[model samples]
Target: MKNQEGHDNSMNTLNRTTVSLLTCVVLFASFAYAQGEYGANDFRIKVDARGQVASFHDAVHRRERLVPTQPAPLVAVKKGDKTEEPSRAEFEKEPPLIRLHYEDCGVSLDIAVQETESHVSFEIIRAEPSDKVDAVIWGTVSCDHQQDGG
Candidate 1:
């Protein structure tokens, strides 16, 4: 009788362990699905230029451009917390171009600028999945450097 009781208790413990593992798996799957949905959302780009040539390396990429001191409308998309605005020195080195590269959940973005007396243009490119290698984004910047007496 004692042996039988021990066996039954062991069996119940095993059953509970299996159920717990299954629950964990289900929760993990749901989390992954949510992340995928969020990633699929669109992102936007907004550039504020100082009306001069600027150069700055993004955390992940490198670029150069010329831009004006004023801000310009570049692109519209989803917003992310990781995005950062370029510094004055960075903008002066290039022509107001922003490049974003994502791989294995890692992201690298570069912003450059071009400046003119009358106008400035900015570009932004993004690669998605962010954690994977299947996403890619590209674009360009247009500025009126002629007006800046360049």
Candidate 2:
């Protein structure tokens, strides 16, 4: 009886420990995904949790082009008249991709990020529920001019 009771207590302790570890992992993952930065050469871009461009910087030029507080998204799906942007975004480093999720529209957009010596490019590789999508809006960016009086 004594051994059985001890074993049961040990099992309960183990279960509690497991649950605590799993909770920590989830919290850490969320914190990590809160923001992401991608860069190459003289350019860098930081994306917020909602997948909006938080910062577009040119190191050589010393300029930040995107308005971090702007409500406009870098990409939006126009379904009929409503423009739906991603409610959440996760960044993946391997092959470089930003996975955007639109919960209301029940769709996902995968934007591929490609960087070169001179520039960075973003291309939408996949858009789910293509039929429901009317148009893709790029951006209404509030930015500083890259150059003066050109």
Candidate 3:
């Protein structure tokens, strides 16, 4: 009876260990699929195309998502003529840039994005220099989250 009890205890321990390991793997995979990844070396980033920057990860940090809530780089395009904003053209689309032509006002903002190993950058180039300034577009990013990717 003593030997049987010892064997049962060992089995219980193994079962608990297996369950715990499985739970961890499932959780990690879930975290991974929650975002789409893009990177330039260590400057890896994730964006979900929800008018937000989804995550940013690096070597110094575990494989955790740095941005989990709120839209990132809130971009707003305004036209002096009160023209409606263009519908949903992603910053992550096939090419990471947008060109807005305001023929009504004779101006445009040629916006470009440059992502690097340590930085995600954007550039707004005027199609031509003009005080006519038909529209303005901008963004803001804020996150200080710490979650172990492991």
Candidate 4:
């Protein structure tokens, strides 16, 4: 009876230790994913005709031009019977600008590139449907242009 009680206590200790270890591992993994690295050389941006956006891993240079060459269509206004085109700055400041379709969520999101850094920082400035808020997603980039084929 004494030996059996000792063995049961030992098993309980082992089970507790295993559970603690698993809990620690799960917390660490969640933290890691939340602070994951996303950088210019590490990911690629996709923009569709309707302005929907997406991102993917950039395996190859795929060095296509960054933006379309043609100017975006301008809105014309008639003021006192005189027609005028919207100014360049007006077009530049448009928001909800790039729509993004989230395949997993079955919901579309709008995104904006807030900032780009050569070395350690990059930020996704905005996302929309407005529900997601203006949280910034930042990560490090391998700024070694030579090594990265930049």
Give candidate 2 misplaced runs (Cα > 4 Å). Answer: 1-32, 146-150
Candidate 4 colliding pairs: none
lDDT of 3 by residue, 4-74 (tens): 55666767778999999999997654433333455666556655534345566664664544555645543
Q: Write the per-residue lDDT of candidate 4 for residues 1-150, one digit (tens) a residue.
A: 226556667677789999999999976544232112223643444433323222333446544323343332212223244433223210112221333334322334333334244322322343334452323222111222334434
lDDT per residue as tens, model 2, 35-98: 6687888878788889788887878777787766767576878898798887988877666778
How much is 19 displaced in model 1, in angstroms? 0.6
Kindly provide the TM-score of model 3 when superposed on the true structure, using C-alpha atoms.
Answer: 0.41
Off by over 4 Å in 3: 1-38, 78-87, 91-110, 126-137, 145-150
Specify the highest-lDDT model's number: 2
Writing each residue's lDDT as its tens digit, candidate 1 over 63-98 gives 222243534323222234342222221122222344
Model 4 lDDT, residue 121, Cα: 30
Task: Name the top TM-score candidate.
Answer: 2
TM-score, candidate 4, is: 0.26
lDDT for position 85 in model 1: 25
State the local distance difference test value for candidate 3.
0.53
Model 2 has a clash total of 0
TM-score of 1: 0.23
RMSD of candidate 3 to true structure, Å: 17.4
Give me the overall lDDT of model 1. Answer: 0.34
What lDDT does each candidate get? 0.34, 0.79, 0.53, 0.35
